[model samples]
Target: MSGNTRGITREKALQLTMRKCEWCGTAIVYKNAQAVYCSSRCRVYAHRARNNPFAALRNEKRWVLWDTNKRPIMPSGAPASSTDPSTWSMGHVVNGHLNIGFVLGDGFACIDLDHCLVGGRPNEAASEFLKSYPKHYIEISPSGDGLHIWGTADEGPGTRRIENGLSVERYTTGRYITVTGRVFQPGNLLPL
Candidate 1:
């Protein structure tokens, strides 16, 4: 065998004596009895691979209300009554409201919610609606049993108008609303 071939065989023999690479799962061959990696290139590739998944998820165009940590503050109990002014408080509004649609920076729109719970339980009617419509909608207060059905304004066929005067504007402290049997202003709701 050539000198390089002989060296490789010797390295392979030495590698059989030790553990393999943790990242690539390749055996580490030692020609000089002290090799750490099967190849130097493999070491560099493994290092870069660690951060690639996170980067890819961020770059994708999707509606994600929660941060990368996946921590969402959910509310408990029934929804506020329409006539109650305290229901619109910040604390109640923040935790009680569900993210129905998102507006992308590029002006493109995407729907996020696939399955949502309504009226303190998964809404069979809404679930059926999704099965038939295949559209995205979010339920903020499943216990109260209301769904915030929405899609990107740019992508939606048209605007949604609720007879109760429901809107998609950001919650303000002055707005009167009710949540969980208690009446409060917008200040009572939790921030997203």
Candidate 2:
């Protein structure tokens, strides 16, 4: 009842096990056995709560690559348009290369805010977008003129739109994204 002490009766504990954020007391709508937090911020707080050293690299699934002409290529020298993330190798990523794509079938999707990078600066709007999911993996686009927010989003299935001279696109499944650990914001995995 005081100083982080919580008391719950049997009925209350049972009900809570059905649904509640372990971190903040918010009601978790999609409560699963592994569900713990209500938002990305809460998730970050939870992971940081434990002070784990390698919690940051949870998303380092694999490295991506592209051809000399800036085309995405798989590890076997085939066009990367069709490849599995399981086979993506870190040995292939070239430094300062223009094209990169994570192997396909990985659950992560990309929220691409195009043209948000300009004049050696990331646009304020792009920063805001990145902040919206502070736990997601983010990076500067190949041209250094855009932002790539990588994490789980609603399965957008290649939705593309334009707003305020920025191209906002979301891709879910079937594609490996241009990935660079050059994160715009780094912490925990993004909330689903």
In model 1, state the lDDT of residue 12.
60
Model 1 poorest 10 in a row by lDDT: 183-192
Off by over 4 Å in 1: 1-57, 60-102, 105-116, 133-158, 161-192
Instruction: Give the number of the best model, judged by TM-score.
Output: 2
Name the regions of candidate 2 deviating beyond 4 angstroms: 1-64, 83-100, 154-156
lDDT of 1 by residue, 33-63 (tens): 5555566654543443343211222332222
lDDT of 2 at 157: 59
Error of 1 at 162 (Å): 7.1
Q: Give the TM-score of each candidate.
A: 0.21, 0.60
Q: What are the lDDT figures for the candidates, one per model?
A: 0.32, 0.59
